[model samples]
Target: MKQSSEASYPISFRKREATTLGDHLRHHNSVVIIGMKRVGISNFLRFFLHHQEVPTTYIRNGAQLLTVIVDLNDLVEREIYPFWVLLLKRIVDTLEQSKVPGELKKAGQRLFTESIQLKDLFFTVDCVQKLLGQLIDHGFYPTVFLLRFDRLSEVITPEFFGNLQRLKDAAQQRLSFIFTSFRPLYELRPDVFSKSSLSVFSRDLYMTPALATDMTTILNTLQSRYNLNLPKAVVENLVSLSGGHVQYLHLALLVAKKLRKQPETREELLELLLKDEEIVLQSEELFASLTKVEQEVILKHHRGLPFSQELQEKGRYLWETGMISSGKKEIIFSPLFENYLHRIDTPVHGGTEFTKKEHLLFSFLKTHEGILCEREDIVSAVWPETAEMGISDWAIDRLVARVRGKLKAQKSSYGITTVITRGYKLVRTS
Candidate 1:
């Protein structure tokens, strides 16, 4: 009899050894002596704060510790005042909705009312600091403010950055903050290039790709849970192809689950990924999430070239995203993706005719070559000036389909395909 999914996989896989940051954040400390002491005090304080009636279960999930998170990428524009205003509103709303102790709820409500009354940046900053102070005084010590951003180099503006600095300075010691970005922090904010700045942002933790052991554990856990009757060799192949990238590994498993028949051999898995157009097309959605520089990093790493030391942060971001592994390796994290890229380009037999739109689309595809092109990217490139005029995905798809027909008729080998979740890429089946 097949074992239950919950029984086979268990929650242990989900709770697999937490990342260093996770551990630190979860315990408000680390395994180190200093961290332990700090955490002990924090825990003691928390224990005292929890009255018998106040349900402690709310804070048990490590969610309460993270008071606020601002995702820079989600903002349409980097307006500091509005962003903070929105964040403050969210905090107030969440607190209002939460079943916290009466005192805490009242304090949160008062802050919300006071925050709404503040109209100027100067007052906003002061009020935020004051509210944080009040929270600490009321035994809500160590309120962690989390700032999460991707591609900070591009997203961060001078005005927005100043606000962050101000908050860091104002909340020092009383509140703890964690700033996370795909790239290194020092590279984004100015004047932090010095050794002193490094000290200010101490405890730099890098999350490398998963190790072999991690992959094995994940695969075994997934296999038993899903009742995927994959052979040992096929499982080994899946690991080998994933390059220990957690994201790609998960994707491969999902693909395996979607297959009608369980693959018994490595070659079958590869065939299911590469030869299957439907499965490969699903990758377009995944491609859409990558920035242009990130896409380049993946392609360059695939081609066995090292990006500049200056570009190392970009590489680190890609590595963190599970697209590529570190070291002198040319391996992409996804075998299916690697195969898809390899089989993208085929030989063009002769001169191919093109429409005005087709010409532009074809040229763009050629420029990008093996790189994944997002739907929006194609829109911007093909209709740069008319982007505001609104180029829909359907328009791009229809244009590409027409172009594909022409390429086939003209006996050209180059093809453009949709990577379902990602976007599109030009493949030449040589």
Candidate 2:
């Protein structure tokens, strides 16, 4: 949904004293803002820049380390360089007025000496230490703002960290360093820096995409920003489907809003959700990644009961990985995923033969609920040539018992039921 410029979502700042950038800036000289992509790291940085008075310099992507150093030197030398150039020009003008030079005058000999000697010198470790000492003498302290430390980790080599350590040692309290990373610091090499000098903000400390609390904040923001009264149920469903990932939730809301603008009814919202290309693509990808055994389990469970041993194993794996939940003996995929699965065609497993006779037997029992089918009828439906082949009644009884045992094992109260003498019936409790 396109929100007006005036419409801004109120960011829910963490309640803890030292959590946010503003809060940390007030107390600590250096603060690191880190989180997953789209978790509002940039927004937080922008917030502090807008609200606070500190000299904020954002190092975007952190790839241009050398450029940053050159820029810093240029900033330091701006005033002096201009004045020096002006003085040289003035001296040349005075000499021309005095008519001291002939060819120098004809050539308009304007001396422009732009020296980056000091800047080039700072590239060396010893020279950088000396430069820091000179800056301290001149009361030119700098607070280094290193944005996207994750990007830096990718771009910079091991020598970069070594040089950074030297820079830190040389500057000491005179320079404050703020490093931001998307990934966890622990995931990186530990020998990169001393723990005391570094500050880490991880998913554990900050709200992660999977958290319910973060999802609530996102829902509230969407409602307030769009001025749309999103139903609580709708928000909950979106949260459950997206697993509280902000980008995914935003996409869902955007699609819903677009559909709502078409003057659709509330009931049509579910259809809108289902039809959204973003959701459809993500769901398809999720289903595609699942194993064939897992798909079989889902399909078999959806049909009714009698799960194969392989299906049960896959179900247990899915449950452990948080893809689904097991209730007693019943396995349930998440509602969102289940709905998506229902919309798609059944997937094929290996070419294992399914008993058609078993299907017919179950179908007959299901059709005649609470009524037993005769042995002759059962044979006719399940095994057509059984009478001619002289298949005993015990064989049919064993098959029924196998079906019942499977049902019982899966904790399904439905399936084949005993009828004492006549035959079997499917008990429909629901």
Candidate 3:
């Protein structure tokens, strides 16, 4: 049984902080909440808006709002000009239809009639100001919740900033602005907003649960909401595999429920998950995007080994690109994605034909528990003289070294053990 977002993390478990939802509402006019997708940012928003008594208007797409602002500016520039006497009449007509208060409607008219410079009229900086002032005069001055501000950073021009500043300056003391972004504000537009201004942005309050807590919560919710009886051991295994990522856990449970022939059994769940072709295809597509070197490195690691120094460097680059992550001594896909990768066949090394290096390595390791062969023997067995010299004994050694590094990095209990005088031996510590 899968739990809904609300049931997964109880409100009581939420973090108590100086900058909590209630605290932010009390102190500031706006508060931004930024987080990874499915990390509960939206859930928190729902909870705050419903439970905190704050009048919150969520602007899901800042880009869309900016587009509207720009279109309005264009309309104003092209339509209302030269005839300054007629401008106020047109502005009043626009505001009357905009549902603004009578007082604000009159103020907008006055501002329009004034000999405002074209530069100031269409300035991006002043746009926000005019909009906010209009909203306030219309009695909409509580708080402006700007979600996904990263999208706006792309379209926000100097003129937009000028208009925004005017709004900010005109806003009442209680009017506060909150902006949410997936990335840091500096990452979006460092030049436009200062570090001091960015500092006012609140960090996302993560609702991450401990492994045990997550497992317990998921099981409880599943049992209560879906009337599904899940075994404690199965729940434990699922949580362990999921790394406490709520989305993965929920997906895993949903998969198990869909294949409901002994959903309580770990082996049954594993079989269903492994045979999921859609999951495998998605995983393959992700792996395919990686560089040849990175794919080779990861495949090697998946086959219970690491890559050479060159390949390791390539793998590191992939990690930085969010394609992979390094654990203790092993290279792994991100935790949320590790299970998906494990379901697919390990890809082969590049420049080498469809040679059975993975099969040979696995078979060799299985057959020779304590036995070690000379370096020459590895080259002869894994790759004959017909094979390219680039993948010769030295190259094989580098591959073995990479495999060893990965094993050590992963801190695997069972790993390939190097034999100084001979070659290598697969040791099963467990």
Candidate 4:
């Protein structure tokens, strides 16, 4: 993040993200970038490679950058051997295409050819390691970018990642990688990450909102293609509706094309937005991309209600992703979205939706339903990450009261029974 912002603030949203990757590469660190669905990270990486932001701007210490991009989306075999083969091939391509000395190119070609002939994963990795070492020795810092690197973590064994970590460690961390995936690293592979160095992340870039220039570029392109006028006011409402999501922002225009001829006010546009099937689906999808805690924070904040500082910390993701703007008052950026949130949260019975804290308390109590849930245990469950912060008794009682009220309102089969001193337990109602 320091690297991304150290330079002047970027006018292009993805450039800001790209700048962060460049900074990490300069420091010899690896980064895994994730974005929400339909955010078009593929195009973003394509932009990075074409622009040469790293080679042209970063890398000032008399070292050139060696970039090998392997778009994993093209992988068909789903086997480790094929994966390694594809990666080595790309490194060879990068070496051949980039302006490196003939000796280095020859060395890379030799290893690549040998890896192809050997048919062994370790051998292929060894070949890659040898070339990376050669590049560094020749005043080049190598960075391998794995695009659409979504499923590799699921398919590849832990050994493959261990090898990758070793490769980086051997480089003294000079070797860096950039991975673009649909899901963030935290959600991508939490299982294998538990016992691996991949968990030691330096930075994670979420799908960012389109900058002002980006929105203008899209609108201009659309105006010329469709031969329809893009009104300033209508466009403002579209940005609000789409929350800076480029594809959906463009889609919003096409969806509302019929209503564009008239001077529809923002409220009128929102009304149409709620009824349009396509727009409704788009809004619901954007909402669904958020986690439960994220959902609660946004809903509370959207309604001008106060959100806890801890929960607000979670909500920072919303601003980073461009789902909301933090001006004088935080804006949800889409009125139609409020309606969607309300509809989904409508209680199946009398049970209203629980906020993040309430949900935490209820989940713990229900998990220990028949047994006594000690106060200490509840603290661990509800605030496991911040138990050292020391929640007050009043705060705990307030949380419990809220959960009890929700359970009673829903007429759930379960109820909370407080023990005299130690704890609480769930009891069945008649």
Number of the candidate with higher lDDT, 1 or 2? 1
Residue by residue across 323-392, what tens digits does model 2's lDDT show?
A: 5544566434334456677776555442222245455666777778778787767776666532322222
Candidate with best lDDT: 4
Give the per-residue Cα lDDT of candidate 1 at 155. Answer: 44
Off by more than 4 A, model 3: 1-10, 16-19, 29-32, 52-141, 151-166, 191-197, 200-240, 263-335, 339-430
How does candidate 2 score on lDDT?
0.48
Cα deviation in Å at residue 368, candidate 4? 51
Clashes per prediction? 27, 0, 26, 1
lDDT by candidate, in order shown: 0.54, 0.48, 0.48, 0.68
* Candidate 4 weakest ten by summed lDDT: 1-10
TM-score per prediction, in order, is 0.54, 0.39, 0.45, 0.62
Off by over 4 Å in 4: 1-19, 40-44, 52-62, 77-81, 102-118, 182-184, 194-201, 221-229, 253-288, 295-328, 333-339, 342-430
Task: Report model 4's TM-score to 2 decimal places.
Answer: 0.62
Q: Candidate 2: which pairs clash?
A: none
Q: Name the regions of candidate 1 deviating beyond 4 angstroms.
A: 1-19, 22-78, 93-101, 114-124, 143-148, 151-155, 188-199, 212-237, 275-337, 340-430
The C-alpha stretches of model 2 lying farther than 4 A from their native spots are: 1-12, 17-32, 52-144, 189-244, 261-430
The superposed Cα distance between candidate 2 and the true structure at residue 305, in angstroms, equals 21
